[model samples]
Target: MTLSTQERTGPGDQAATGVVAIEATRLEKSFGNAAVLRGLDMKVRDGEVVAIFGANGAGKTTLLRILATLTRPDHGTVSIYGNDLAREAERARLSLGAVLHSPMLYGDMTVEENLKFFGRMFRVPGLSARVLEIADRMGLTPRLDQRVRELSHGYRKRAALARALLHRPRVLLLDEAETGLDEPARQVLDSVIAEHRAAGHAVVMTTHSVERGIAASDRVLVLAGGRFALDEPSSSVTLTDVTRFYIEPEPGDA
Candidate 1:
């Protein structure tokens, strides 16, 4: 129930046939009369990457936010790394790394200062060394002393990503992470995702770009009408298929 208790039991207690990194069942959310998420169910296994594609207002960000623990669902339950999110929020957070639209950084803080601050918060071991390592990996070593507000959007995003990875979280939740990144920066992001997968972590991301989504994901999920319209292996789907689904209505649409 409590975070400490959940952590004491550890994720190993729940590990079975396949290690499930994220699980959400009967998820629902609404803002006043408008329903955003409707009875969604999802499961992401360790070492897997799942990309969610949806048109605007299709609840893509909303789902990612819920997984990030930024918002609570109106109904249903979520688990992260086998910890019940509702009951073990703190423990669940320890397994999550998120790169949302906003970087969630202190604009006035230097890049190094921001990473140091988050590293301390996450209680990352070898804080100083970890900061340098992540900064270099993210191509932020040169900009370490630059104030976050002074950095370009791409650099700031890299910083945010570094912060997210500071503690080596096992579940990655990326909400439009590649929105403004250039080719190199995007490549860096792709590399990071690959590394995470190689290390047996799980990634769930939302993207509008069909190419990037398909390229980066092992599985593809199309969210339409507040529910999953398509769930299939990325290797079995094509960009044209995704585009057609987005351009046209679902088969039963009136």
Candidate 2:
């Protein structure tokens, strides 16, 4: 059942308007002889947060990479904010912000430098002030001059997030974004997500933590065998339910 506006949680009001922000159909991918994604499909609407949970090697990262335009699907179609990824890739990317497993930062550059570089690439107006604003928001103000390689793993992740948000893209794709964050950092992350949703943006995050995933999303999906085995509103499922569904072996698993 669709939750009414009053019944909805986590900034879903704009999401209820039915504006599709990211759409993927028949996505497939493979490496060598092992097929990772098998005809997967997904849709995320503006102001919505969708969490995809899966075991390691369940193709979660691969799927996010494809959606982020970092990797191409063997055969599939992806559209972001009405821009076709294949034909309008540059335009499509203008609306996407992604934090992948790699952090996607220049290790030798300071945090501020990294943000400024990306901001320039996006042709952000008022780049200097925008860098300061995002850095402060991400708790990287104190580390602005610190080289990415000199920071701790968590701080590096924060820097990557800062870069991702610098341009205020319409869709944010996070691949295991909470993995290295501490409690305080996580709280900041939550606030950032809330602000993003409030702006009618879309967020698609992949994670292995069922509790975190469900808590941070309006919808929850379990990726297994390259397909969503379970897709339900976050409010409809419990940790136990997701855990049970997740542990069940796939059809051909011995």
Candidate 3:
């Protein structure tokens, strides 16, 4: 059963809210002759940063899409905050805010306009105030009227982040969120993620950079050749471990 609002009456999402924020079991997906995921079991608790790492075309995008409710899994059960993804799709979707590499915004619109539009889509109360809050928080107040396409990569990334945070989703799925970002852009992404983590939302991101992944994530998962391969806590694993795992696989490289 889903937790009641009474669970959140106290500070933070109250304990009455059972912890398993995101859960996937034996997930499988295939594209004709190619298989993207194979019996992968993944889980992320509330208020945590879990980063999934993978080489190019290692099914990371597929996994992110499935979890974000953007794509259907060929087989398996998934849940977000105690709500079933397949059985209660709308409920499950309401709990998630996703940012893929595409930014998922209208480039023709202004930064503030795009955020306001997304706020309206989520039916957020006080849409204008919320838009301004996000804009200010992301240092976008100066470029509020700038068209999204006219902005630099860094500002566009910030705009995308603002859109994701508009409704305060319980889970944030970031598929390659840090890709194509310069130093400053990457810093902004890191700071925004920190903000999300501090706000008690479960964040799951996919990245190619081990350093960035470890720095931003509480846990690291390596998906090799389209399977849920290596999973470990970020604090416990070092860059050496990441290098070794990538350069050389164990005896069970199946």
Best by TM-score: 2
Query: What lDDT does the true structure give each of the candidates?
Result: 0.83, 0.83, 0.77
Residue 148 lDDT, candidate 2, scale 0-100: 94
- lDDT string for model 1 (98-159, tens) is 99999999999999999999988888999999999999999999999999999999999999
lDDT of 3 by residue, 116-152 (tens): 8888878999999988888888788999999999998
Candidate 2 lDDT tens digits, 1-254: 22222233343566767578888888888876677788878878899998888776778888888888889889989899888888888998989999888788999999989999999999999999999999999999999998999999889989989988999899999988888899898888888888887788899998878898898889887777778777778888788766665654353431
- Total clashing residue pairs per candidate? 0, 0, 0
Task: Arrange candidates, best lDDT first.
Answer: 1, 2, 3
Off by over 4 Å in 3: 1-18, 247-254
Cα displacement (angstroms), candidate 3, residue 59, comes to: 0.9
Q: What TM-score do all the candidates reach, one by one?
A: 0.90, 0.91, 0.86
Q: Supply the TM-score for candidate 1.
A: 0.90
- lDDT for position 215 in model 2: 86
